[model samples]
Structures are given as C-alpha cells and as structure tokens.
Target: MGPPAPGDADDGTGQRTGAVIVVAGVALFATALLAGAALAPDVGAAGDDASGTLVGSHGGGAGLHERGSVYLLDGREIAWRAGDTDSYFDVTKLDNGSVMAGFMQSGYDECGPYESPCAHTGFRIIDPNPDSGADPEITHEYSFPVRSEKNSEVHDVELLDSGEFLVTDMDRERIFTVRGDEITWQWNASQRYDAPEDPTRTDWLHINDVDVIGEDRYLVSVRNAHQLVVVARGEGVVEVINEGDPESTRGDPTLLRQQHNPQWLGNDSVLVADSHNDRIVELERGADGEWTVAWEIYAAEGVNFNWPRDADRLANGNTLITDSLNKRVVEVNRSGETVWSYNTPEVPYEAERLPEGETVGGTSYADGGGDTTTIGEGRDVPVLSFLLVIVQTAVQTPFWFTEVHVAVTLVSLVAVLVGLGSIIRARVRARR
Candidate 1:
C-alpha cells in the first residue's frame, strides 16, 4: 500500500507532523528569501566592459572631427574600479597626452570632525599608453590634505601653465589653486554670496567648473546658484551671468538654470551646457552689455539631449557633448547635425575629445584597452548582484526597500510552501 501516515514513526514516538512541516517551511522560506536578496544586483557597482561602436556621420576637417579617443567619467563603474578610489568625478586629456582624473572615497576619518564625511579625494595624471602587458602608469598624484576646516571633495582639476593646479572644492564652496601641497589662491563663495539656507549644505554653490578665461579672470559655473560668475584671481567677483531663478524659468534667454562648462567661445560669447533647460546655449554679450542667446540646440530641432553635463567646442567648430542621462557621448556640428557618437554602457558624466593623435589605453575609444571581449558575456543587468544589494540595503537601510524587494519576498514564500510539502511527503515515505 502507500507509505505510513503522518503519525507513524520508526522510533515509536509519533511525529509532530504539522509542527515539523510548519517549522521546515518557515526555515526554508527564510533561507531562500535571504539567498535571493543576496543574489540581487548592486546598482551602485561598476559596469561591465565598454561595448558598442561609434555611430553617425563623422565629417569635419582633419582636426575638427574626433580623431583620438575620448575621456569620460563612467559613473556606474567608478565606485569599484580596480585599484582606484571610490568615485570618479572628472576625466580629461592632459597636454602631455596623459589622462588627468579626479577621484574620491567616503567614510574616511582622516579629515577629522571639521571636514566632510568623505576623504581620500585626489587627482592623478595617468599614462594612457603604457608598455605591452604593463599597467597604466600614474605619473603624477596628489591627494587633498586636510589643511583647513573646509576640507572638501574635488570635482574638477585643470593644470595651469605655471605648473599649478586649479581645483573646485565642492564642500568648501570655493575654487583654489594648489602649488604642490599648498593652496596659493582661493575664492570662497560665502565671502561673496549668501550662505545656503541649509547650514549643512556642502554643495551649496555646486561649483562644477572653473575655467581660466583670461590673465586673471576665471569663469565659474555655480550650478546651485543657477548662474555663471566671472571672478578675478585677486580682485574677487567681477560679473554674474544670471540664468534667471532656478525655481521659475522666465522666457528671458539670458537667464540660465543649473548650467555647466562655461567656456569663452571668443568675441565675448560664452558656450554653456544649459543642463536643466535641456539645451546648449551660446550666450553673446551685445553692445548693450546684456547677454543673449546667439545659438542653441534643443530637442525640438530633431536633436536629442538628455541633461547634457559637458560640451566642448572642437577645433572644427563642432561640439563634443556628454549626454549624461542618455549614457552616450555625441559630437554635433554647427548645424546641429550629429557627426559622431559613442553609446556607453552606463551614465557618462563628461566627455573630452583627446587631442589629435592621442589615444587612451592604446585605443582611440573608451573601451579601456580596445578589448571589446565581452565581460561576463555582455550581461547588462547584474540580476544576482542586484538581489544581494536589495537584501543588504533592506537590512541596513530599510527605507531603501523597493517593489522589487517585495516581489522577491513573495516568490520566497511560495518556495517555502513547496519545500514543506516535499519534506512532509519524504518523511512519510521513510517512516513506512
């Protein structure tokens, strides 16, 4: 006949059939839930190897067209870049054909109580072309030391002709020049503008860029302030190019909202990536001393830009744009025609077209060594890692739990019931 009933047991002691199954189900359920959650992908983790070809019609002159590889801050991969720091903020091509980058890590106590929570922020100049089988050489390195109570993270760095470095200190609301380890010049935002409403606001000015416009003048993009300020090295603030109030966008073309990369385009005109406005505007100061939009590119003109963060005027009068949210870098001509484009696997913060004949990692692309061999078989979503991230985030920061976590939990519950049923049947058969 069939196996023994639930109550039957070889030891002569009747099994607690209901309790055993219930407990087994609960235990299995818990285990599966944790396992699944642990296996989920980590969204903050680095992305896979760069893949995809450059698209669009690449025309323009010998130097106007993008000849060399472009440098970018791959947002997704910066967190866990091997042998590197926590985050990559900016990447640019140095005059010596090297790559200069800014990186930062958090949760360090070296800066002490006066500084922000993050530490180990620094900039490095890397040799993109190294010997065969050799790693990229870091020729120059400088980590920000805690010199003042205003220790902050660096977002942008430019090597000055005088062998000095200009850097933006986000937390300190200042742009400072560093000669070796000492701060030679600095301009604090608080000294000129009102402090942000929130006293703890570290990114009040959100100074994203500091470009030397003239002998002693600097063009600064005060993102949070929704304006561009031109400051003299010693004389202090000189001009403020207001882009209107960030809260309300007026029809005035002069007003900017959350802009970045204000570069002098010559003839008293400025080219800015009007980020929040979803356009790139060329502002020109007329004889009336008022700034007006000379030209612009918007989605309505069949041009697609998703929160572009950086735009550089190329030698051929073309523009290289870092389409941040689109996860791509695009080069467009003066007529708003897309000439060249590279689609990244993750968000790209900035894109700098390297000088002619300059390449990174021996390739003129962002493929990180021209090895397009798919990493992890070209899987876009790390499902297993995401599950683990979800579980960990749920446990550590419950507020981070999302609908995906709920779905995983429900699936685990079903698995628990199935496990319990199988165990009950197997135990009954063994008793017989």
Candidate 2:
C-alpha cells in the first residue's frame, strides 16, 4: 500500500516478464516437502498434472568427495501450476497431507504488480492427491502489526500436533503460537531474554527458528545472539546450549550473528543451520548444561553452502537440507556425504523429508522494486490474479495469456462506452 521497506535490493535491470515466469516456477517448487518417516506414494509417476516428485537415484563418487557430488537417487522434479510463489523462511506440514508455507511474498524488499513481496504472512496448501492438478493457493495470510509497520516479516512456521501453529516474528524478536486464528502465547526478547545490554549488542538475540524439543523444552535459534537457546515451554527461563560469550568461541565471532534455522535431533542434541558460518552444526548439551559440538557438516572452508536455511534428519538417517542462496536441496548420509541432491527451480527457503525418501522444499526470491502488496493492502488485482492460477491449475490449461487477454478486452469495452457518453454530453453543452 505505502512505500516498501528500505534496504531492499533491486537493480531494476531485468525484464518484468522473465522475472514473473521464473517466479512462478520457483513458487511451485517451494510447495513440495519431506514426507514423514514413511515414504510417500509416487504421485509424479502416476501422471497426475499437479503432482511432481524428486527422486535422487543419480550420481556417484567414492571418497569424501567435494567437487563430484553424487546423486544416488532418481528424483522427479515437476513444476506446479503458475502463480505459485515460494519462501525460504518456513515450512509446516498438516496431518491432512496439506502444508502451510510461511512467508507469503519473499526475496523482495519492495512491491509492485506481480512482484509484491511481504514477510511470512503468505502460505500454500498442497493436497494429498498431488495428481489432482490443483494449484496450491496462498491464503490465511498472517503478519505482526509492528513488523508490517517496520517492513519486517516472519521467519518460520511450525505446526504443533495439537493443530496449533508457532511462528518466529523476526521484527518483534519473539516466538508466537497460534490456536485456531488467535495468538495463544508469545516470548518476547526485549523484555524476557537474559543478556547484557551494551556489551552484547551485536549478539542480542534475533530469534530465527523454533522447534519443540520436549514437552517442557523448546529449541530456538537466536541469530544475532549467536546461541541455540533452550527455553522451558510456557516459561521464561532461557539457557544457552551453544555459544555464550562472543569472545569465547572456537570459530568466527560472526557465527553467533544472524544464525538461521535449528532442528531438535534428540533430547540432548540439536542440528542448526549456522548460516553466517556456512555450515550445519550438531550441538550436544551435558548434564551440567555445558555445550559442545558433536559433529559439524561443512564447518571448514571450501564446503558448498551459500546460505543454508533449514534441515531435518530422515528416518533412514539422511539429512535433507535447504541451501537457500544456492537454490538447491542436498541430501546427505550420516557420514556427511552427498547421497542425493535436488536443485530448486529458483531460490529456496526451507525443506523437509517426506515419509518416502522424497524431499519437499520452499523457494524464494526478491520481487520487482515496484508496488509490493500484503494482506489487507494492494489492489484487489492480486486476489483475482491468484484465483486465476487456481483455476488454470485445476483445469490444466497451458495458456495463461489467453485468459488474461479476454479479461482485458472486456474491461476495455466498458471504458470505451464511458468515454462515448462523456463526449456526447460535451457536444450537447456546446450546442446549448
């Protein structure tokens, strides 16, 4: 509605049409996900229009190789219908074979036309019948009030088994849980987070991702704080399971700054996407609350992460990782060797492993530097534009331009009539 937040990147050198086409593909790729511990049915093989699967039975190399990454699985990557946008922020799968993708519009700092980008309010739901050819639609948009004011956004979404949802509000620096449509609980960093104000200003907790570690414990990633904070569920006590002080770290000091997503592996250990450090670290907590690194992937330089966002451990011990900036998903065995890999059609956010070996992921990108739209803002055009995508996917139509052209023609006809009426009135007045 108003001007988009500043500090957004828009070179304004690219073509609008090409950007839209690529954005559409990326949006579709973002909806796929990691099925639970069990393997998912091969929807792509069934010849369903909307169903697309990525099987990773390709590539090979023996040693702890780096250059020649092997793809051992035969994965299928299918394009979803048009207008399906993606995110690199959050991914939540529902019990009914549906998914809630956090971050409605991503990548762009500003908004305009089809290029409107917002924070985490936007989401897409995928049906169990992937072949139903139903395009995933974006809806149930949610955003924090202050975030919207400051142009901040949501970083992730977690679906609780109780049908509730938890989201990381980046701007507010807190975690919020939603029941039905209301915010049930929140943990604010400014007031409750324990930290020395002036000394650790650069390391102040910038809550990024949250995961349920136990009935009484929750794991959260604090980017700027440079720590994996373990907090009691529904309580205010926060303890650091990773780095404490910036000076006493084994690696770079910036590692504690702007850390990304974290996943709980078990009671005493967790996996974190240390984005700033360009690696994933497995941290273990001892009885005395001391933390140590158990194992780390790509900790040293020369590893391939561009900006890994989120990761999950599969039943078969494979780790499905979202390489956000690289626009790809890497599947690695327990030994940290690449077992399978899938390139995102565009920039991606989060990824998960499904019941079967297949992995679903969220793609992302910055939109144009023009008008960006959010929920309750922008012209009704985006609403209608998105609805058309739904119809096109449902009907399995190949030509979107044909449908748009007809709508434009009809609107132009009405404008012509209005103009003719005004011209006749001017003639009548001149005669008088």
Where does model 1 exceed 4 Å of error? 1-83, 107-109, 114-117, 145-152, 196-200, 243-254, 300-303, 356-432
Q: How does model 1 score by TM-score?
A: 0.59
**lDDT tens digits, residues 1-432, model 2?**
565344232333223333444444444333221211123221112211212222111011111011111111224444332233322245554566565554433345444322344333423343434467565544455543322312244556667767667777655577778876688888776554554544212434556677776664667776765777777766754666555554652223433335677766665656677665556655666566655555556611113454466666666665667654444576665556566565554445565555332222211111222221221111124344444334432332222222243354345445454445545544444444
Ten-residue segment with the worst summed lDDT in candidate 1? 357-366
Residue 370 of model 2, lDDT score:
23
Residues 267-379 of candidate 1 have per-residue lDDT tens digits of 35677788766577767676667666666776322324545677777655666676555445666666665666655543455656544211211111112222221111111
Instruction: Please tell me which predicted candidate would have the highest lDDT against the true structure.
Output: 1
Q: Assess the local accuracy of residue 372 in candidate 2 as a C-alpha lDDT between 0 and 100.
A: 19
